[model samples]
Target: MSQPIALSSEVPATCRACNVRHAGMCAVLTAAELATMARSARRTQHAPGEPLVVEDSKLTSYANVTDGVVKLSRVLRNGRQQVVGLQFAPDLLGRLFGRENLVNVEAASEVDLCRIPKDVLEQLVATNPVLKQRLLDQSLQDLDEARDWMVTLGRKDARQRVASLLLLVARRCGAPGIDDPDRVVFDLPLTRSDMADFLGLTIETVSRQISRLRHEGVVQVANHRHVVIPSLPRLETLAG
Candidate 1:
């Protein structure tokens, strides 16, 4: 394939100041490439529960989540939505090379994103083999997580499942979850009802397990959403 037209412009200040630019999809880009991308890039923020992409909708833009949680789900024929995946900062938010969205994506918390036009991303992916490879790498990582979750949902008991869910958030946690190496803290992205839906457990069961964890000193909760894990080791033990 022929090389892309060389650019000589400086990257935008917004791109330079971005928190996730160094770790996100644009990380693999050349300085000129970044300048090209920034020419059309726009920063966007979303409130909790705001929809980013809807199932079966035509694709127009892609985003790199800067800070916050995104929930990806799909609607069944019965119009019920199934929670399929969650995305965090630095994760690319849209599927590449797709015409229409396959899932409904929403903000699980207040979100910040860098939106890149669809054509811009597609052009980059075409001429940049590294970008394509990185997309594949991310997809494989997602597939691995899904397989692991299958085991969690199928084999793990209610308590273990709850612990596993907590661990999942804690592992990818930012801000509060970033400071302590041994401790993990973050707001619960999913509510009890949402948690029940994701975990394939009843609301009462999830509530009971969380209360049990609190009683056992495995975790601390406040405002019904805030979670503080004093010991990662202890939480991992419970997840098993």
Candidate 2:
């Protein structure tokens, strides 16, 4: 069973200033509802590699990411593992009605979370129609992303897959406030090995493709994690 972490001193009051308020589960909630949620929610932090939800375990809570990233993956009977998805800030975690967790959810980076007990979340969803609809919409969006990734895995070559993954991450990160959308800067949350797992490629292939993109001037690597894209249009063409 997962243990509850103590609430951070900054919670509740800080909830009001959260960037995801309008886009997250709190969107449909009124001030009173938000207050109620704030009271029930506890802030928690996880360091990289900490497991938020262990595979096959009983889930007792659901959480919203307030900072950093979380990774969702599963291991086969043979012990081979694959990274299935990533959850960034503002993304919801945990299956709403599910009893047991199907995958391991881990902190991919230093992470902050606002966690509500599963029972509390369930009760709220049962009584709030708008909240339920928001959950349904998020579910549909997840489904669409999964389908799109399936196509990328099945149809794209190594280089195209790498480009596509960069594009996806850039979209998630959004363009840095520069006037040009074509010039984007973001840190890669996934390691090369993680990228290989997601793209269905070998680690060597993933690295080779990234090097090729850098060599061709499609992107500039500030370091192992940070990336700068000079031309979004060119990257999209390469992704195709």
Candidate 3:
């Protein structure tokens, strides 16, 4: 507790899991079981724009974010890309099931993560019913998010998409609901380009849409970070 944690360029062969921030995922571990997990985790860092995993890369480990943001994107053969997901603080990274990578992972900002060997996690899950149940619950939540994103990508227009994304960020940051009947200011954590990708719009289009919102008195965009929703219900309807 006396020293600051350092990020590593690569996962050290011998690392301790006691350093992880979100060890509650392993809360059911017995003292001995916890010690085993601690021995298998390594701290790693990725600088902004660095690739953590590319399409089709072999999956060898799972990770939990300690700091910054990471993006999960898919690149098409024609060089187009879509950001499918973004990981913020305490979010998990990497796919399980030993499949080759289905998306590319990159640090959207300078990032820190706790890298856990897949084998260790699997062993823990096999012997520990509580850990297994926790993983399943987390997986179910992720599946729900995937379904929502599918709707965003397949059905929602740009305006709706942006609205939905903003709603999501607001909720993640502690907004009760899209329509809480209360006016409040929430800050946007993503860049223009990141917002565009998440909403499937060009940067210019995103800029224009935001301007339109401001002009319409629907929202107030100040200093490129804060969003003041004048009418939460109206914003929710427009976001659809």
Leading candidate by TM-score: 1
lDDT of model number 3:
0.72
Clash pairs, model 3 backbone: 17-38, 160-239
- Residue 54 in candidate 1 has what lDDT? 85
lDDT of 2 at 43: 87
lDDT of 1 by residue, 1-240 (tens): 433432334556777788876675767777777888888988899999898998989989988889999999988899877888899988887778878888899999999998989999899989899888878888898899999999999999999999999999988873344666787778988878778878999999999999999999999999999998999888999898
Candidate models: Cα lDDT each: 0.86, 0.84, 0.72
Residue pairs in candidate 2 whose N, alpha carbon or C atoms collide under 3 angstroms: none
Better of 1 and 3 by TM-score: 1
For model 1, how big is the CA root-mean-square deviation? 3.2
Candidate 3 lDDT over residue span 1-240, tens digit each: 122232332223233333333243644455555557667777788888888988898878888777666888898889988888876656667665666778898987778887888888778778767767766777787789889989988998877788787766655442443555456566676779988987888999888888888898877888997788767777778877
Q: What's the TM-score of each model vs. the native? A: 0.91, 0.91, 0.76
Q: What TM-score should be assigned to candidate 3? A: 0.76
Which stretches of candidate 3 lie above 4 Å from their native place? 1-24, 27-31, 174-189, 216-223, 226-237
Model 1 gets an lDDT of 0.86
Q: What's the distance in Å from true for residue 8, model 3?
A: 26
lDDT of 2 by residue, 1-240 (tens): 222222334245666577677666776766666667787888898888888888999988999988888889999889988999888877789888999988899888788899988988898889888888888888888899899889899998999999999998887764664787688888888888889988999999999999999999998897788899898889999998
Best by lDDT: 1
